[model samples]
Target: MMEYFYPEHLKKMFTNRKRELKDLEYTRDSLDKGTLRNISFFGLRRIGKSLLIKEFMYRNPGNIYINIEEIASSPEFFSLRYIGYIAYWLNENGDALPDDYMEINALIKKCTEMNIKALTDAVTKLNLEFSKEKRDHNFLLGLAFTLPEKICREKNKKIMLFLDEFQALAVLKKSPQVLNPFALFRSAIQNQSGTSYVLAGSQITKMRSILEDHKEPLFLQFNVLNIEPFTREDTYELCSKILPGQDTDIFESIYKYSYGHPFHTTSVCERVKEYSEKCELEITNELISQAFLVEVLSKEGNINKFCRYLYDISLEKARGYGILKAILTVLAEKEGTTITEIARGIKRSPQATKKYLMWLEEVDLITKYEKTYFYKDPVFRTWLAYYEKGIELGIMPKREMLKNLLSNLEEKYLRTSSELGRAKEFETKVKLEKKLGIELKNYMSKDGQIEIDLAGKKDALIYLVEIKWKNKSSDYKDIENFLKKTEKSEFSDKEKKLFFISKSGFTSSALKLAKSNNVTVLDRNLEAIEAVN
Candidate 1:
């Protein structure tokens, strides 16, 4: 009974879909003018196909929308149900009926006057089962088509009917009736001067085959439009509008996790509301980490819901998925690792790795640069790193899942001390760059010989900082060897300001070396130590 920060309109909160909406509207307008007849709105599940069409109908009240999945049986039943719906709409509005309704009814009645005739016709035409469902379905569609023209004439208004999840209805072609009423409907509405048809479905392949492929009856019948995710700016705007004062990072995290999928974003935000309420501190990295890692992936949450979705994908694909995930896990910890490096890390052949990478790319789950691949959505990466494999591979029970996840969280938090120091050292360099009027560059040298964690330059002066978590006093030999290594490297022309960063204070020997080498030691734990200008 808890609610999070989802848009109240559910998927209707879709904004910045102007291009898609305009294309759809343009198609509808063309149909009103009797120029366009068949249109298909197709995409993956929860990609806003249904909601988009529903919103379209809201603007065009005269339009009729039918959920084909709910009514699908046979071609006849499919037609009849829609016809019945049309009749209900007309009668409620006090609209006049078509003069030849009876005539069309009688024409369809001959197709299935009795069980024997229905089976006989089905056998010869479709080689399908002799079912009453097929007969009723065919008859209904036959009636449904006739009513559209009648309604147009009676009301003197145009009608646009959206066939929802039409892929399911397309299946009845396997029946004895071979009821391809969609094709017939296309013919009926084509330039009928008043009727327009919008065919929409969530199953990407099925809908694509129905309306986009040339072989299908409704092929190339309508404009094809794919709904995409909101941009980072739009998502941030949406989150700000709905949940004021929320951290921009939280919204950024949502966008990264949901890949800007509205449903997924809202799904996460809804929970974020609960998590925010339960916690006293304002939403921060720690709060989000706890909420997402401990709360959402908890046994009581929807981790199993996520599992069911993955279960539907093929097993080979799933294994490839695990390997891809392992690659990302390595990359997350060791940023900028190349493809050859990833192949070694995942222990898969480059050829095999490429295939997995492509699959993830196709699904918008990951991105590849030249040959290297990284998780496209950070939240998905978080989910994969924290929740996915453990649940899928049965590495732990539901309770243990939370425990291990929290354990990893603790380890990451502890590890941050080291990374944070490095980050702050870079931040200080930025400040120093402004003060010194120079630019700074961070370089990762190959051959594992020379590495500069942070560097900044101005004119002929260059400052270099090396980060170390160990106490400086204990690192005298390491510091000497590091300087010796750097001193041996090739350099073009710039004065170097070498610096050593350590948690522990510098030893007399290292400080002496730094002084002699013209290197400065700035211990990270001691931030008050300003740059020796």
Candidate 2:
């Protein structure tokens, strides 16, 4: 069994990421066929990018894993770790080596024992250079980066190079010893035939700039793969593993509150498990909510600390930290607000507010769609809302305060649900366009009180659609309401065909009613609406 870089417990707790794993495996297979395709994994922090990489490494041994954030404190340290990791992976049983193997002398001794003279000699020379009064930075970086490919060719072995938090390499440039680190790195790795690189970063914006920005040296050099949050099913599966035999509703609530974020889902479940064991309570929605609150609001909580770190670190990277925070606070209060509205809220001019908003976007704290800005992580926004309200640790929140927080959470959930509904409508629109081969426009009345989910003109007739994404089946009354709305709308005078799409299918009464009214009803099983001749 290959020793996992992550702890055994965490490895055991790892849940579904089959798609990402398959994608990684494809890269590995390509490498086996003598083709190297570098990949870049980018996502929000704690979104399992590192875990996914470690899992891939565990499945495919003989790989080098380096967390640049851990080792990129200085040029020399980074070079040493780079050499050490290469040597560590090269050894037949490197995991058994003493912890000091990270040191140059230990690595040199180990490489000598393994008969990897190329690496040993390189490490020795690098060690000697470091001791000198004047060191050539380019020589050190060039030697460190190219060592793997050199060693790989020497031993006739393929290597997978995983660089977690790879964006930290930019920090090395602050040192005179490592200027233009990314360009130098790109230069060294561009020709590595035997080593495939899988770079991952928690800072999405920086990673995209490094890999996708046209001006960057490494532009279009690596295939970008975004590690998304776990799905609702994955969240439930993980929660069940943490607290087995729990009700479906409990897991649903966990998915709802955690929004399928792996770390948050895990934290919420662990907290719930602790409370259940200590207080001898059954798992309930209220308990889950409290666990979430404790995880987010308690000072000693992991998520709280993480949010604080993220807030501080992100602002540290961007200019106008103070005003950036003010902008974040405004977004936390009312997300999806336009920059002009935000400027008014912050009492700043539009241009200044736009600059601050750009700073926030640069840091990946918020994203802009059209003219409105929204927090990239809604859970973080919720935390900020509570944090701004002074929800202190060591003291229970007052009843009124808890009530207010819950109310706010409920309102936010409703807004999120509405957004999801809109997403479903969009998905339906796309499917309709592809199925019917016609572009559809969303229909809304002048007063905006009446709206059709989708409408398009096909074969001299107008097709109107009403989508129901609720948990329950669309009932007879639902179809009746749709017909009434269409009848009262501006399109009433037009020859319109009616269509109903339901997520959970339709009730028998609803189906019969649709048939009698010449309406087409499609459920989840129905792929597309048939075009009437």
Candidate 3:
């Protein structure tokens, strides 16, 4: 069994997050120059929000980090427990850090070694007049936020406080009427001269309400940073770190499985490594696929917990859980379905289904693009597909269950792969027209037996386009048949031109035939065809 990732282990395993690091550096520079405006970061869970913050602190000394997820569990409700973390940093870094701008609270000073309740007791012992109105959230937040600002103020230094899982403050609400400690944070730091904050969270709805919602306290007040997945080059680098000398196909398989999600990428790769160790199996496509299934379906504690977290958040605390589950199934099984289509699938009203989609979207389970909705996590969609398909076969026909199951997964992969093709085709159409200077329209034969991916007329010449996405290079026979059929059927008397686009480059024969027949070939970006002209 592999050892669990500890802090030291993590520091080694960390992949390059260039964009996120650059963003943090920009924030620091802006703070020094006195132009920094926003200080909040949001991303999907396990997409590495916490990891980024930790890496920042590791790289830069004199920074204080606290996980709000910890304070959320304290019995004292809300208090200045984080002051202790800063005090520890102060003691550890000493003059290497900025001098204390103000007299450190005796109680807050002990924050380095004591519990939050003990720290609160020190506040009482000192008889501080922090809050005469109430010792509730505002009062506690006032004391906590002040120390960091003062540290910044007198020394002319910027104390970077990283609050991980910051949306916990939104969850820590005691009552509807209680003043939000989060807003207290905004008010405290908005005008403060010396402090910089980096608030990070994974709860999309709560975090958005705290920072993006119009009526919320911190509405649009935070500069939000989004951490995207690793690029292809970075993903390859990460894979190499795990297991070098692997085939390029292995890395591509991981990339397709992870779809650029950081955590999923790491998890699947690690599990694949384990499988290879135990079974001495070569890293084949089948090996990668099974590793993915084992990790996603595993009942091991942390994996189970993570899956539960996904299920709970995606359900958004059971607001129409069953119906929403049905909705999710539809979204998983059919990519790019609108609310109406999902509603029809689940036998619900479009309006009701739309409301559920809003919740799912707010929770970051799915994202809406124009008129269609898609699972934000493709691996999660794959899991759902497996479950739904398993139930449909009713144990399968006797002994062929394994074979049938493999067939089902293959079909799911095809559907998922087809989604990429659809997106590529649409993008290619726009690029070809923009780059080559022509207007393209979706062309379907009236009989519906034949169709062109894109077709349009440019003055005296009519053009037809076919965009094919396949693992293998496209061949001449495919293009030849399309041209012959269109010539004989619709444009026999019209002067015509044909363009063939492929994700994989055309075969030698395909290129030769296309050149001799006045056909142009381009890549997905419509780049190569300019040379053909």
Candidate 4:
């Protein structure tokens, strides 16, 4: 079994939440002044909401803690189930519940014991009774407050009631009778002379839906405090304990991987501690990389779950997404390209392509490059490229560009390697111009075509190469079309070198033709393609 590294410093411990502590303190003070009763806490999952309540109970020994999520198993087990649980808690804690508790429990038990016909009659009367003067929910909630009073009276001190995941109880409100009971409970808390409630939950959506929604049973009736994730500084402080001599770079790396997500950050640190026991190296990029790859990336289901949601969308939407993904893949790889160019690559008009772009951005799956619109997000792009094969045809603008560049290069410099073998009678002019550089003012005659791949300019020599990942052989027509484009376009007649790269070796004829034309033919195994910065 792996021992989890639970850091003591600046973790999601109750002591660290200054704002939450202050807010709860204010609530306690109000309760002491006999002015406040209900308070709500909301945040994302595993954010220490339950822990905060437990801490509050630790400080106040005279408090009753009830987690509604645990007690309320189904909608049918409403007041009676809650009453039964309270009865059990009271019996185990000290003695019998007060008169109000006994009274509510007996009443609910009687309603349950009655036959179907009698139960219906009783419910009808209870509804009328509640509608006329509000139900006796106060008695049940009053039980919570009364317990504190009872304890305070015995111990000569005040008590508090901590109800965790209280939102689960609100599910009962779906029934009219259950809802009436809530109003009475609310009234009881509102008029509680002594006890205070610290309600909390890990489910932010459900909690808000129940408590914050105005149309719901409990709305605007409680003060709310939301727990935020730890800041970068706090995370750094916690990490420093486990990583004694680690530098700021390690902290930055941790933040990058975790994005200040408390659970994720802590989990990584726990793994790091385990790794450090064997490895002597201090925390570095390499170590962090290993941690991410081994501990986090090794868990694949997380990303698969996100993609599964996209898969569940309508087929048309999915296809549109495929098109969106491919275009974004190209855009992401190239950083940014003209919108028109993206449309042309995808075989769609600019207007058609813009719609899908808007939809993707709306969902936050991808983002634009500010003034320039480019697509990015490696996972999304990769998912689209692999899963949505049908739509990629639109995303790749340079579909034939790679093949054309390869053929052109083969014609120009296909025999450079062979010529080197016969160096005794040959002079080589195949210069390795800046392993990578940019070219500009290279002529292109057509409006939408005819741009030279590489050019030797004074400022930045361009070394454009085509990428072919799929096709093993280039078609002659592609090469012919490129030549025709170059001849017709009005591009600069500057000295330039063309290079072609393919996933597979070029055709024999294309290779010979390229050598005659002074083109450089590169096989799939081109070394260090990213040699140029």
Candidate 5:
């Protein structure tokens, strides 16, 4: 009978995440049918994992959401909050209870007043047990975790329990009486029929250890859902909502700088709105540059604070914090560097640096691919570049310094986007080759005036491909340009097959032109291209 409340502003700001919502709903429906599949959501800090959970909880009633970090000061405190939240969530017209009713005494009294005998008894019993001189922490944890199932079964209802920052529960193991809290928790909920758990945490390393490491108790117990950054389309939609009347170019600039991260995108958009309102000026790339600099470099900025927290907390959790910091600094300065280069920068041996890099990787601070390492979040890397240099807090940077930083950022964005585009093009080429059974390579004119992303030759036909890995659909103009380029290229004499691979599909006119001209258009679904001889 508890009504969950989602704020109006949040509802307005919430963008497109229909797929994630559907996934959550599917799990909940499965649980309703007497099958429980627990889920654990993992993402980097400020990646909107918590917001997604909140939105899900708002839509779905009969749920209890607890942020473990806020209450998990000790085993005793966590036990009380666990029981209190369940009681509060189950109470009839629970909104009447004072905000602080989650306190042990308030929860007990509230439950008793509501004549919720099941929850009342459970809370009273827990309070009495905790007060005992020789408390059994294991028994207390079991009782706290199982109370929801017990109460829900009595009421002939089901409950979804969302634990944010669930990895914080590991701290309970430090208590002598509670040797392994995760084991106790898994044991309690392993066979529960009435309650399903959804665990989420920002600490990717700790969460992975708890849920994926075979040695851990909760290993493989929950379905893992990774909360990724918003897509470019979603980012544009969100920015449009925040700062209306902006052109596509402004929105694209925001997406390019934010990289579709909800926090970054929101921060930049909100900052732009502020500047536009105060100065009565239009939103431009220059304005975006100033907003981004303020958000990432200003001490009071939300993004700066978040990055600082991420930097400090990640180091706190990893071993050899000092060396790990050095390795991160090295990567922030020059990403995609080899272990030997990193060792040279950090003044450590390659072997020692590799160990430190592994520690950073474990914390999800940096990732390794093909023997080189890069920061998992490029925005964070940008922040660190200034942070490591002791960028003064709350001081307006010199114009030259700001220009230089923005220039570097623009360059980095172009470089990273190009790299990603190339990777996608390569993937598309491989897929096309497998589907059509043809070998492809990059093709360029002798004067470099026209370059094709991919080209292949098989039999009498030469394939010239133009790949558009962008947010917008390939339009008639794109197809026209490709045709113009082909007409001027040396391949004009050869019997050439044309391919247009667009990630966002093609516009109506583009499709019509492509079909008429016998140009195979491949979207994300490359299977359609197989029909092309």
Candidate 6:
């Protein structure tokens, strides 16, 4: 029973989520005015959807929270079960019920018995107004709608109800008795006033089926909110708190591996701290490598959990499990590839491969850019690459997955690191432009050979930026090439101000030479390595 993210005491120590919190607050306010349009949002599993909604419920008093997945498929959810759940939650203040209690309890019992004619007769006996003609409709709907309405009226307060993993309830639609239960609920609850209802689900495709189907009950009824990863600043701030005294490079490595995924970041940080302390070593590149093997390369690791989630969901969506696996294997074996290339890898046609690729994109497991598709999380892609390698070599047992990791390490690292470096430079251009208060111009030579990460000017000087996100620092040799390019008469008038950005900083000699030549070395700290003017 080891807890993730530090310890039991620190479980509720939420990190940077001000934006989502503000948004939920706005949602509650709008609900008070009945102006909020969206009631349902979708996100990937473990992307903190439940945690986010639960926290919002805690903040907004009188909010009722239910994880529908727990009782979704069972008869308990359809019976008077939800009424009891609401009653229990209300009694948290230890209060007695109103005077009409006997009649209410009787009605609840009649509703639970769930004979269509009997329930219809009970509704009439009670003189309850029908929301939708009151036929043999959803048994759970009337009660769920009534509870919130009653709570708001009796308690003299508005209420918010958060239903997490609501897609699980779609299972009930397949039943004969309550066909299209979602529409029934929509009809009942949409009429109720003074209560805000939020619905959320994890499975992207299943959720779309429930909420997006044109013929379905809840189609486009709920608003959508997608919770994304923390920004680099938020990620860095969190790492500073979790791993005090760790250098900037260490923090960058944590972000790089986790890809700003909250669960992944916390899990990796916790495990890194655990193993580093156990081995009596400081956190370093080498130590992180060891931690990745021991903590995540194991069968029950977070990496395995995410990979399995991807596999299961893909199986559900794709035409055939073999084709889906082949597509994932192709992507995992080599990323940034086209459908044609992937099809060729799996010996399938491009048209056939495109279906699986589109399905993966629909599930948010992968993203398509121009003609190439890649896993959203680069680390996940890395893990899959090695995973396929292990399976290809017939490596048995989960613990033995890392047997050939060393053999595959150098080349894979080189390829992935180079890709990340190129991506980060593009990001750096934005960061530098914002920090310097100017936009950088981009250009390519007529021969399409020359490229620039960033080329802008400040006042009367030219700023040429280079970003490297690798273990080794940029050396004097790198600056030497820039010096040669600048020697052209193209830059004779404007002074050259070189801004060399490196995650690992520059060599001492590079710093010395660049200092003499007016070069600005931006070390891992993102601060200038000031060469004394």
Local distance difference test values of all predictions, in order: 0.56, 0.80, 0.68, 0.50, 0.79, 0.63
lDDT of 3 by residue, 214-330 (tens): 777788767787777776545656776786778656776777767767777788788778768876878887777666655654554233347657887557576688998888888
Regions of model 3 farther than 4 Å from truth: 1-6, 73-77, 92-136, 175-177, 300-305, 388-404, 413-533
- TM-score of candidate 1 to 2 decimals: 0.53
The C-alpha RMSD in Å for every predicted model, in order, reads 17.4, 11.5, 13.5, 23.9, 11.6, 12.2
- lDDT for residue 324 in candidate 3, whole number 0-100: 83
- Cα-based TM-score, every candidate: 0.53, 0.78, 0.68, 0.45, 0.78, 0.65
Task: Enumerate residue pairs that collide in model 5.
Answer: none
- Scored by TM-score, the top model is 2
- Top model by lDDT, which number? 2
lDDT tens digits, residues 399-506, model 6? 344445644654553243334454455456657888888878554333334555567877887777666778888888987776666554355467767777888877
Off by over 4 Å in 4: 1-15, 74-157, 173-184, 278-281, 293-295, 300-533
Each model's total of backbone clashes: 16, 0, 1, 26, 0, 2
lDDT of prediction 3? 0.68
- List candidate 5 stretches off by more than 4 Å: 1-5, 92-100, 317-319, 393-399, 412-415, 419-533
- lDDT per residue as tens, model 4, 1-533: 00111223423433345456656666677767766567888765555676666555444433466767765543333443444433433333323333333243454554455333323333344434445554554333334333444443443444456677776665655555444444545655554456666778765566776677776667887778887766655566556666666766686567555545565566666667666776554666656644533342233323333444443542244556578656665564444556777788788898988887766554445556754563333333333433443322121124264354334323432222221111111111122233443332223322324554333444433333433444457544444444454445443254555566555556666666656655566655544222111
Model 1, span 157-219: residue lDDT tens: 677777788777766666665557567666665556676777777656556666767877776
User: lDDT (0-100) at residue 69 of candidate 4?
Assistant: 75
**TM-score rank order:** 2, 5, 3, 6, 1, 4
Model 2, runs deviating above 4 Å: 1-4, 92-98, 393-401, 412-415, 418-533
